[model samples]
Target chain A: MRATEMTPNDKTNDSTEQKIFDAAHELFVQKGLDGAKMQEIADRAGINKALLHYYYRTKDKLYEMVAKSIIHQGIPIIQKTIESDLPLEEKIIKFVDFYIDLIRRNPFIPLFIISEMNKHPEQFIEKILPARLPRPEIFLKQVEDAVAAGTIRPVNPQHLLLNIISLCVFPFVARPIMQMVLGMQKTEADQFLKQRKTEVTEFIFAALRPR
Target chain B: MRATEMTPNDKTNDSTEQKIFDAAHELFVQKGLDGAKMQEIADRAGINKALLHYYYRTKDKLYEMVAKSIIHQGIPIIQKTIESDLPLEEKIIKFVDFYIDLIRRNPFIPLFIISEMNKHPEQFIEKILPARLPRPEIFLKQVEDAVAAGTIRPVNPQHLLLNIISLCVFPFVARPIMQMVLGMQKTEADQFLKQRKTEVTEFIFAALRPR
Candidate 1:
């Protein structure tokens, strides 16, 4: 529910170019960069290879566009949440809530980006960050403010941010293992995730509360 | 550090068959099942195609063996940890410690298993679990005992397990993104992970402590 304010642009639902973009995104995320094929993406999009090339002349270009699109859809929300005027506790809760929802919707995105990024770090840094880079400074300052106010125990801001991000995002990213370990059916797992909205917020707050 | 108690059988390090197994594992994990080639695996192992076939007849057979080996190596350690008689808090800390070490050593294993499981869930359950399945009862009992004793808050054991696994394993699985978001160079990220041995334990303890 905390994610209501932010809406990710789902290109799959939009225009012809967006359909091509969305199809490419799905293929790349599911099959990875090397495994993904431009012809397959075109076929999936129900478009000719010529038109697919018209929108994206190369596989690399399509991959970069999808990565940038994903980053643009998700990172700015985090940047804005932390950069907002909300208090630390509220901001942290909002951040976690929004992120869990985002990842739930785009389960493969974090893995897709991370795998592709490691394979092509230089390309990702050059392509993605310039498009819509995350502002860690905004988040770091909020953590610092919370620590300063004795609202939370002293911890490195980066670690704290990483902790929050990990807790919110990992379940979605690692859903298969989670389902196995938790022994839940898909619908059951969905219900469990719904419960995490409050459970995760409370857990983070409890961890951060000054002793 | 705690993982010293449990060692994953490195079939990779033992015999000619193992070299094939290890090489196949590396290719399959990195490139995935469809993207991996039997001949390429033979080349990576410095062995002949016929010899590779002599060890494992088919790609499907080889993939299953690798999956079983990975599950056998990792899942039992978790089962043992939860089944241990340590006090709840100490047990939780030890579980976290062992898992972080495990994932730190084999960063891609989690992503590999999860991705592969999503693609071939039935095959994994039939092949991997029958070999060395995790027993959730031990973990559930421990959590129930802790709750009954007022040692921790009354949270669902499955959720708690998911949270612990997420907090411990996620940073390593999503290392590229973690490095980018936290702005850490590879060495710096390694150092940060070292610190998580303590930081993650403390955070979990803080969250679970009875209020």
Candidate 2:
């Protein structure tokens, strides 16, 4: 049972390097950066320690690769969705859909992020920044337009952004507890969470719409 | 210095264990659980490893003490806050206040919870249920009441509750990057987070209030 063997396509010249990343990500999530070991990563990748270093030079460098991969995977969607020409409510729906899907694709993304961010937060956030989408001025404008038309109450765009994220992200981050407390089974939890895209935007708009 | 020395009024045979917990809490935050060492904990507590093992048995056991202590500190507040006769809005306000103060007092609390929770989630959740608040049904009913009375837009109460939590918790868990992104120093971050209690409650109430 080779743990680290990869298909030829996955290797390229970077195959060894890629193996190191795959191992690092798994170990990082399971045990955190400090708990993860270069030796273990080497072993997991089916390579010797020298070969592991030959690819990535250092543990920190390899970790940065994984971290960047995560941020790149998650952040661009938000930037594009919110900055799109979609309608206000539709933008929200798309935003929620984006995160819910992202979490499903990467369930550990939040825990991985929250844990590592807490460790060397300066490093994590800095890594995340260059990838940050341009301000969703369109989303903000949509929100203002809704408020002006007396469709929603006046609310800060930043706080509104916070609201959208909280509903979408929190459940996935707290899934184990949420599932237990809310009496949901695995499939049930997935379905209910998927249903949240519609539930959340309507709820927020309902709350904000002026009389 | 005599390791395991007791205070003049100390009588509990658990003093050594208590010292270990206090020391572990500080070190876990300072160096993380993995980074922290048994010897370091011993040095800080002024106790020997033999006594530590005598009380807790292993490093995991010692960590359990810290996790349990943090859980004990917060869980009752959730129960009492939810089970109380306070009005919904007031309850919301108080919960925000409680969480903010608690997180502030131990800035590392959320990170610690997320970390250990990720490490052994089944064990953690089995030990302390996040939904142990008796009669969460009451909060649910209140949300339904507001929705039915048209005092607020229709919302899944659970989603709204989740929203409030994410807004409050995420920034702290993501403190390192958030500070960099917002260009805030530690004191500035403190003030920014401090203001969130009022901001989060009002934001929810505003968004949820009847259109």
Candidate 3:
């Protein structure tokens, strides 16, 4: 049924479905698709196995839901930020700050998404990613314009986008190893990550600055 | 038994053990510790499950050995490169080129190591890593000395190190998603990555260049 047509009982059902989604997302992120068990997800949701089955018939279906939810939630925000009217340097600062904060709030998402994509890129790229994937053309064009206008040095927009993202997302993806290598505790790690927003922004601008 | 003390029959046993290790490494990287099955690994090694168990009694033991093997092989190469007497600019180029190539050849290892580390960090950080980890002190000190001498702009050496590694490693970790986003085929992806050695090196040096 459509959301506008939902009755009170449907709203109650929606809350239960949300609970299942929350539980499934947590388990999937923590243990991945193959490693996460449906029974455990049901238990985590505080619902019985039968009810969990009734809501989502299989782990695969639930996993698809969780993955879709993440993409749907993230893409719009990204599109808005990237497609914004800001200058390239300001756009980059905004992008880095926003992305670092987003990953910090959802620490496991980068690794979970990347690992799942590695395991099954056919499914992820074909099914989970919407037909209207977030387009970087506008952002790429802005980068090209910046170079032409001599606002920034000439560089490949694709690599620049990848560099910005890599700088933001990789620390979180490699957090366990980073923590171990840097000899950082949880608090220190948080502090280090907090510093990266400004650090990353400056680094990007410095790199882009015309000689 | 030590290699020097091994009997003639021990050579055959060592070869069988090597087969098990290779098969286990492949499966573990592809399927992870929980998803990879012992029987599958045994079959991949062209041995019966009994023989596999005779070589390594449990999956955990086998997984640990594989993880350690990866570390033992990689750390020395990394230490040698970082501790070399090259100038900082040359060192950064070498590090980026070597690392990107290493991950390209072993495409799955980045995600495998990061995901496995996320799953059981205490075990991975404490046990899998050798007591004498590849230290970054020499590299960090070099960055500091360069900054003090006005050879590069002032930047946190830790963040700089992280950025360099992140630029090198994150592409391989996120290759599938990157391909989908960049609308590139496998060959294109390979070409893009090949270009990154120069792209990444120039970007880092540009960022580090003194104003």
By lDDT, the best candidate is: 3
The best candidate in terms of DockQ? 3
| By lDDT: ranked, best first | 3, 1, 2
Extract clashing residue pairs from model 3: none
Candidate 2 structure quality by residue, lDDT tens digits, A6-120: 3444555456667677887888777777888888988998889987666666677777777777777777787788778988877777787787788878887877777776667
In the range B34-130, model 1's lDDT, one tens digit per residue, is: 6688899999999899887676777888888887777778877877887787877778888988888888788888877776666566887777665
Best by TM-score: 3
- Chain A TM-scores, candidates in order: 0.85, 0.82, 0.91
Lowest-scoring 10 consecutive residues by lDDT in candidate 1 chain B?
Answer: B1-10
- TM-score against truth, every candidate: 0.85, 0.80, 0.92
Instruction: Assess the local accuracy of residue A152 in candidate 3 as a C-alpha lDDT between 0 and 100.
Output: 91
- State residue B106's C-alpha deviation in candidate 3, in Å: 1.3
User: Per-prediction fnat values?
Assistant: 0.59, 0.51, 0.78
Candidate 1: list runs displaced more than 4 Å.
A1-16, A49-51, B1-16, B48-51, B129-132
Query: What is the full ranking by DockQ, best candidate first?
Result: 3, 1, 2
Once all C-alphas are superposed, what RMSD does model 3 give against the true structure? Answer: 3.1
Q: What is each predicted model's overall lDDT from 0 to 1?
A: 0.78, 0.72, 0.85
Residue B87's C-alpha lDDT in candidate 1? 71
Candidate 3, B53-129: lDDT as tens digits = 78677788889889988878777777778878788888888888788878878888888889988887787877787
lDDT of 3 by residue, A173-198 (tens): 99877887788899999999999999
